[model samples]
Target: MTCMRCGREADPPPRHRIGFPAPVKERILQSICAECWKEWEGVEVKVINEYRLSFLDPQHREMLQKACFDFLKLPEQA
Candidate 1:
């Protein structure tokens, strides 16, 4: 199959693990090639929720901080 993103021809598709906790199974999974997966591994999600939370009346800053800390303490992959 051809990769939708890179237009490269791919070998028989291998199952991909992208979403955490629950895995997302793609049907037309040929959209991304192996090279795209390698590049995606380096992408980072920044903590930008603070700006949005500032508008809340109760100010969930403390709760949000604790959640962030707890998430960071999750077990690391071997």
Candidate 2:
């Protein structure tokens, strides 16, 4: 698989365990490599802490999803 973030040939991430919808999940699985996803996992924690995001808020979840897409270098969602 060619990573969308690094543009390198590498293995795909393990699975779609996150709560994103099927289409978004499919895009990530196909475009994001395992290494990038692992990196994002680390970044995700920082983002949550820095922003004081609570999963109980829908807006915060959307914000995090946008951040994830930006970090992955994916195009904007429709």
Most TM-score-accurate candidate: 2
TM-score of each model, in listed order: 0.39, 0.87
Q: Which tens-of-lDDT digit does each residue in 1-78 have in candidate 2?
A: 899799999988888555676888888999999999999999999999999998889899888999999998899775
Displacement of the residue 28 alpha carbon in candidate 2, Å: 0.3
Over 4 Å off, model 1 = 12-16, 20-24, 45-78
Q: Give the alpha-carbon lDDT of every model.
A: 0.41, 0.87
All models, RMSD in angstroms = 12.8, 1.5
- On lDDT, the candidate that comes out on top is 2
**lDDT of residue 55 for candidate 1:** 18
- Local distance difference test, candidate 1: 0.41
Kindly give the stretch of ten consecutive residues in candidate 1 with the minimal lDDT sum.
19-28
